[model samples]
Target: MSDLPPSVRRLADGLRRLPGIGARNAQRMAIAVLRAREGWPEELADAIRAARGNVRPCGRCGFFAEGDALCEICRDPKRDGAVLCVVETANDVLPIERAGVFRGRYHCLGGKLSPIHNVGPDDLAIGALLGRVRDEGPAEVVMALGTDVEGETTSLYIAQQLRSLSVRVTRPAMGLPMGGSLDVADALTLGRALQHRQDVGA
Candidate 1:
């Protein structure tokens, strides 16, 4: 049984459920929140609630947005629709955006194909991706997926699907940490990696 107050213990338990947050870190964060001067907890709760309520998947790319329609990036006219970058998740968009090397639009796959977890191509947004590619008629599709087995598998599948299309498919040049999440990579590293992407074969 936890000796902390019910509210504090509840918050700690909830925090612990988050990825990378252990019991000790959760307890520390809970204590820190308890020590805050003003309505920090309220602010945090409001932010969480706002995100949960307002954020929805973008219609074109599967990125998170405040409305039921497309996200800001996908809606922007200045973005290069002729080139699309395929990534694993909505969060993965941040690092690529930060790199500023890609002026193109994005296609979030929701996740990589994981046969072990029973997550197959059907489970991902592959159909939507194919539809978007066919409709948009992009010149190129840049795959910014991780270098893990699942990532490679997903990339190959996407490349295979695009083979009949006129669009060129490519993968980022080596340099990114294998099996690493793009969300955590430095901007410069990612930019360099993007600048040297290699063509994917048919």
Candidate 2:
């Protein structure tokens, strides 16, 4: 790293910060960007900056949006407002949307309830989720989170919290594994999971 120019090394470090990027990959990417023709790197940089500055979380659903407006999904007039799908992070939203099985709005919890990790109801978007339930009055909320221990705990907690509300809580069934993340699941699998959903307590 010391042998490389300071700017190149810095670019590599920046690339490494992205998810799934490792040392070799970041260095390769940095080298490619440095060797690219005029205007390409500047375009990438400008796009990155533009996204960082303009993209904001949707106030109602926690998905990414431009400015203070709701995300495209939440703003869609044809989406099934009566059905809401809840997931752990904004990344999880993309896969479900790709599956194209659900035409409802979404709520991103940001994370799961992990007692060992010191994450609790307050740490997640539970309050916002409850508020959405009350305000939007969705007839059902599908917990599209992972199937791990933390996910289970969060699911049950959410079900309990919404128990008093006149809403049916369910989870994707069949296709997902015991410790699967929705982001990594295939589109067909996710579609099947949504199609064969099961009630939370059942």
Candidate 3:
């Protein structure tokens, strides 16, 4: 590392900040970027800047949207408005969609409650979700979150918050392993879980 040029070192450091990228992997990626065709690095930078500038979270569901527009799912008329699937992050929505079992709308919580990490109800999209439930009058809101401790806590909190509403709060069943997150679940597993969701008492 001491022998590396300052620019290369900086690139490696920046790559290292990505999730699951260790020091060795970041260095390899940085080297690969440097060795690519002459214009690739600039193209990559331009693409990144474009996406960062043009993409934003959907106002209704927290999923990826272009500018102020709704996400594709939110715009689709075929989706069922009677149900809403709630997840932890925008990325988590992909695996569930890939499962092709849920045709309802979605709500991304941004993250779960984690006292150790100083995350609370206010830090998430819980308030928006409650407002949606109240206004939209969905018959069901699936808590399609992880099965970890924080996930359970967040689900319970949301369920309690919606206690006065007529909406039924439920969670996926059977297929997912304990402590598993929605993003890591396979399509088959997610589909089965959604098909067998059980009621959760608030």
Candidate 4:
């Protein structure tokens, strides 16, 4: 790394900072960018900067908000206000949308509970979720969280919190395998899970 020029090395380091990108892959990407047609890498860099600068979290659901208003999902009148689906992260929202099963609003919790990782209920968007539940008056809150232990812990905690409220808290049904990630599951499986969700701690 010390042998490479500062500019090339800097690009590689930046690439390596991205999720799932390793040292070798970053180096290759840097070299490829250097060898690509004129303005190829520059265009990509500009787009990344633009998106980072403009995209913000939705004030309502915590999803991507393009402007000052609520996100598309939150603004949609056709979506069911009686139900709300909660997920661990923004990434999980896309998979559920692709499944095309849910017609309710969504809330991204930002992350799941993991005491070992020092992430607690306070670390997530639980407070905001509770506030939404109170304000929106949803009939049911679907826990579209992951199947991992941490996800389970998070779900249970959320269910307990909402127990006193009038809303019913439930989880996606059996189609999702235990310990599996929601993002990796096929659309069909996810749709089925959403279609037949069961009450949690009922």
Q: Say which candidate scores most in lDDT.
A: 3
lDDT winner between candidates 3 and 4: 3
TM-score: which is higher, 2 or 3? 2
The best candidate by TM-score is 2
Tens digits of lDDT, candidate 3, 109-202 = 9999999999999999999999999899999999999978899899999999999997899987658887999999999779988987777893
Candidate 2: residue 134 lDDT (0-100): 94
Compute each candidate's TM-score over C-alphas: 0.81, 0.83, 0.79, 0.78
lDDT of 4 by residue, 28-55 (tens): 9999999997897889989998889888
Model 4 residue 1 CA deviation in Å:
12
Each candidate's root-mean-square deviation in Å?
Answer: 6.9, 6.6, 6.8, 6.6
Q: Which stretches of candidate 1 lie over 4 Å from their true place?
A: 175-202
Q: 122-191, model 1: which lDDT tens digit per residue? A: 9999999899998999999999999889999999999999899878999987668879999888897788
Per-candidate count of clashing residue pairs (backbone under 3 Å):
0, 0, 0, 0
Ten residues in sequence with the least summed lDDT for candidate 3: 1-10
lDDT of 2 by residue, 1-202 (tens): 2468888999999999999999999999999998888888999889999999999889888899998888998889999999999999999999998988999889999999987899989999999999989998999999988877898899999999999998999987758876979999988778988988778997
